[model samples]
Target chain A: MYDALKNITFIIFDLDGVFYRENQSLEGTKEIIDYLNEENIEYCFFTNNSNYKIHRYKEKLLTCGIEVSEKNIFTTTKLIEHYLFENNLDNIYVLGSKQLQDTLYDKYTQNSINPNIVILGMENNITLKDISNTINLIDKDTQIIAANPDKLIPVKDGFELECGVLIDIIEEYTKKMVQVIGKPSPYGFDTILSKFDKQKSETLMIGDTFETDILGAKNANIYAGWINSGNKLPYNTLDFDFMSFKSLIELKEKIKEAKR
Target chain B: MYDALKNITFIIFDLDGVFYRENQSLEGTKEIIDYLNEENIEYCFFTNNSNYKIHRYKEKLLTCGIEVSEKNIFTTTKLIEHYLFENNLDNIYVLGSKQLQDTLYDKYTQNSINPNIVILGMENNITLKDISNTINLIDKDTQIIAANPDKLIPVKDGFELECGVLIDIIEEYTKKMVQVIGKPSPYGFDTILSKFDKQKSETLMIGDTFETDILGAKNANIYAGWINSGNKLPYNTLDFDFMSFKSLIELKEKIKEAKR
Candidate 1:
């Protein structure tokens, strides 16, 4: 059962709940990173959140006492840039955060009239009017893409509506399909694997979210380890065989035990 | 074939697109009204729009050269008031226009925390934050009701999203069924029929929209007449029998011919 962890040389970690929730670092953040560094095991952070840039995540990680290069982090914004470039998509309209808008608009032309692609990301202040305007801009030919398919993201107070809600509204109204760039889509997972020059079998994705982290690992054909960070597994697991740990400390102990 | 119009002593008219588009009166509005008046047939206006008060609708109809009492105009706001009163419900939360808020809040207690019902209506400036806040206020026991299920309303420029979109988002996110108060639900039609004290067989529903006007008539077990008004009939009609009129003048002529 634990033998699968022994062959895992490269690891992909989901940020938010796994490493740090909001600005506060969770348990075993520094310990697991230290253990991975000592073992020469490669690991990188992958977040479905497109709200902030890579520097913000890097700064946040530093606050958690885990120093990592910006190259080791992969946000959906980065994955979207790669996706657009690879697919030769331009003339964009983004219904997302300022950071996402600034990043994508800098690389591509902002066409509100008729864009080649319409990118949707999580925005705190998104309005129905904005969504309506986005729908108006979208014609039959315009491509729709989203950062992630997480309907609601757990916040300090309660669950806040995520990018997936926007996707639902847009897709239902426009009757168009929205391509998700983040987890469970294999685009982000494949992109991360290719960047690290690692094979799927050699990589293990550890995250709190089962739908994205575990299901995404399965989708990308990578080994999965679910870190129980106060999130319940959905009723139907679809019979996925993934290692589960109570905490990152437990995960670190399991990896050490496997190696020994 | 034309004998159906002969039995229609009481007529239910859908205001927008049928009688008028915005402030401009469409062709045959006054003609149909005059014909109904000459024949001593009872008629009233029923609109899914909850934005305006009854007075505003009366004024709009007056501008269109069709003067009917405010009592004869049934907006969703008025119908919702009736619904809440009839169902013995209070402590309402409304995500609608200013008029709707004023109307409902005037009658029912404005409860943000643990309300008995959450009412959804079309609001032009509704934001995602408003929707998110509305979702937060809703508990498992809270009853969700929408003013209408019209997905889009034809505007001067293009189609504006209606209450149906709000229902779509709320229902999808909350996994709650929203009870619709307006057309195609039979609540509005039933209320109107009862108020007018007329049987469904002796009534006719004339409107431009097939889904709301035509399907609503079918749902209410009344005669339906679809006035072209530039709206295409849906692909699948479920084999419903209904009359079609190019304009109100044509409808008026058919009734006259049926009488002759």
Candidate 2:
């Protein structure tokens, strides 16, 4: 059914829940790497997780036995840095991680009493004061820019809240919409396309989650292949048009057959 | 023009900004007290400031030389207490002052990680952690109850952000509507009416701000006389219908002339 895989020039891969869960890589990831190499299909990694830098992601990918260059990786943290740079925003108040904060430390304003922007990212240990300061800053005309809009994220024990939920709550309180710069926002895909010099028609986005990966691809006007990995189709799958496969192994076999 | 004041058997006076600014009482406050006494009209002091309890408000009024009994004082803090008591909500996460928290300490839950309800009120030194906790708590289905929805308050320095602004931000973050208990909410007026057993037509709400006092009166279906005090009418005045007078002294004169 995926005869279009032969025509696909570049592929965009989502990191978490696709290539790896947390500490371990998923089952069919190595197969995908081998198949893509055999087909000479170029691929890049994209993640909305702003907690880690590109080098850390590369190290993690290396441990998973899937070797990739640092330049081939894209994260929301990098996207945010680009966004801030583009908008000429110097003074920023961040509700994010130590890594994300350190990445943009020069632009970080310790005081939220007044700021040019308030960047919202994932913070597992987010406190009430962080939210209060952000609200107050927004009230003072400081804009909010979220790293991504994923509501719930799978943790070791259970699912924890994400940036989208935080953004939802903040937007509800302040009556201000936060600017998002991750998957499903099309910004990440746009960045990837621009960097790789690929056309939307020739590029394909592949991942497990339909909300981010598939929707992001659709939003960017690119083809998407939902890697179900032999799992039941998610509810959002019906709403969007996309090719579905049981596993990356099954997808690769189809790609090989399409080439014949 | 306020012949309605002659028919007003009960009067609700806003304390700060109307009768007084911060430290000193305004010019017309004493005259209103005298007029109410001479006419045998029941009058009470109503304020949204939850910084102090009833006794402190009484003491403050005494210092201003406008002596009134404790029974004649009504505050948003008291209204919130009544609301919590009525709702039987004991497990509360409070964002309020030390005095206000102590006022309802028996009901206040020391932490918000898990609470039946989150109560938002006045906190001059509110932090981001307070807001983050509130947002997280709300995500757990904890209900939100607010003292008042006043966005800005006149302080010794200038207009400072109020509990309403915090509530707005919280509401944005949580997507939960707060149940307000103070001016413009109608809950306070309902409590006042039920306590005094006066019909809306026979009661008058007098104050300087149209957003709170007059709007509350309008919401409660009660008559309202805005005390302009020879000052320019506020922006919200055009949106609401209410009697206007230069001062409470001028309103009193109109009341006397209406009787004659």
Give the alpha carbon lDDT tens digit for every residue of B149-244 in model 1. Answer: 988766655567788988988887789999999999999999998888999889999998889999999999999999998889999998999999
Query: Top lDDT: which candidate number?
Result: 1
Write one digit per residue (lDDT tens) for candidate 2, span A1-260: 37777788798988776777768777777888887988788899999899988999998887677899888999999888888887788778888888888888765445556778888988766654455556666764778899999876654534466787668767866788888899899888998899899999889898888788888888899999988753346654556678877766777777778778
The local distance difference test score of each candidate is 0.90, 0.79
Q: Candidate 1 lDDT (Cα, whole model)?
A: 0.90
Clashes of each: 0, 24
After best superposition, candidate 1 residue A100: deviation in angstroms?
1.3
Candidate 1 lDDT score at position A78: 97
* Best prediction by DockQ: 1
TM-score of 2: 0.80
For model 2, what is the C-alpha lDDT against the true structure? 0.79
> Which run of 10 residues does model 1 chain B get worst, by summed lDDT?
B152-161
Query: Where's the lowest-lDDT run of ten residues in candidate 2 chain B?
Result: B152-161
